[model samples]
Target: MFTKKILIDLDGVLNEYGKDKFNENYIPEIKIGAYEFIEKLSKQAELYLFTSRNLMLATKWLINNNLDKFFKDVTNTKLSSYLYIDDRCICFKGDYCNLFDEIEEFKPWYRK
Candidate 1:
């Protein structure tokens, strides 16, 4: 059996980020349905917590929220994965020709 590797971001994907003022040691509430999402995904793929936040704090947050079991690791380095579920990302088509234009025109769905 083969499970697809997935890297899921923490801040805006799993956590209700920007809902409260930033705190280094505190992770805000989990996003609605985040647990359910992870639970369902965990059953189908390998999950990794890919974030720039502090690993210790993130681990504590996961433990507190009872979500520690779903993830294999918390990492800042990009690892091998089939998919990456992040709030702020653009899907690339391996064409560098339009990369600059794409970046220049990209907006994270918040401006609209």
Candidate 2:
């Protein structure tokens, strides 16, 4: 397999998230299609679950969900990657003028 690094967020991305913010010892539910999504992506890229939470907790969750095999690592740092699949992000196509509006209107899918 080619080296295509893809960093994915955990709490609100792979896992089903609620309004509660990311915290330790509180593992959110696994989002629907998460394992399938990971399975497909694993074929095309080196996936690293990027989260702000503790690695041990995340690891346990991943293992329970049968997702640990698909990911190369769980990271807090953003390493070099071809793409970042995150739930909390706004695509900026170089339109700097509309950035403020986008930010203000930005609500993660989990929030909605």
Candidate 3:
């Protein structure tokens, strides 16, 4: 089975965007179960971080949250990656509700 490369967004997905941006110099607490969900995905596929957040902020967040090790690479606006995971994303498939279902059943998981 082939595993798809995953590109995850940091803000608004992994971490909440509720707090003041300036106050969030730190990792800003993660969303519920975000870390667990990513960790699960990381085991089966090549994980990459693709975010518009500043390098310093993004790096600090990853380090503090213990997520840096899960990612193969971290990319900002200057880079490109396949299969972006973001809060503000449009589904390629007509049925948006099945997005997670699709990802969960992607390869090895589906074969199982």
Candidate 4:
């Protein structure tokens, strides 16, 4: 019944992800404000947790954090959605200019 589908990244976006360590069995604690943010967003759109980690692991993380109810699914693939909320992305402004500089200068919020 949602009018929009939002794909939200699990690590840096929703959880503490300052480290590059990759483990299928481990996911960090939920980021501050993430629970409230997701709760609020869920009222406006359907949310999907997008991650490179195992879907079952991600789902379990959500459940552990009591956040599973806000998401429609956990997916590794980028599904069709109204917006993709990722911390590792740069919004393209329809110009190739400054793209390289932006890429080189880019740092996820956690890094800054």
TM-score quality measure for candidate 2:
0.91
Which residue pairs clash in candidate 3?
A: none
| Estimated TM-score for each candidate | 0.85, 0.91, 0.67, 0.93
Residue 49: error of model 2 in Å? Answer: 0.4
lDDT of 2 by residue, 1-112 (tens): 4689999998788876775675678888888898898999899899999988889999899999999999999999989889988888897798699999989999988566
- CA lDDT scores, all candidates in order: 0.87, 0.87, 0.72, 0.92
Give the CA lDDT, 0 to 100, for residue 78 in model 3.
32
True-structure RMSD for candidate 3:
9.1
Best by the lDDT measure: 4
User: Model 3 misses residue 85 by how many Å?
Assistant: 0.9
The TM-score between candidate 1 and the true structure equals 0.85
What's model 4's lDDT at 12? Answer: 91
Highest TM-score, which number? Answer: 4
Clashes counted in candidate 4 amount to 0
Query: If ranked by lDDT, best first, what sequence of candidates would result?
Result: 4, 2, 1, 3
Off by over 4 Å in 3: 1-3, 19-27, 77-82, 92-112
Clashes of each: 0, 1, 0, 0
The residue pairs in collision within model 2 are 16-31
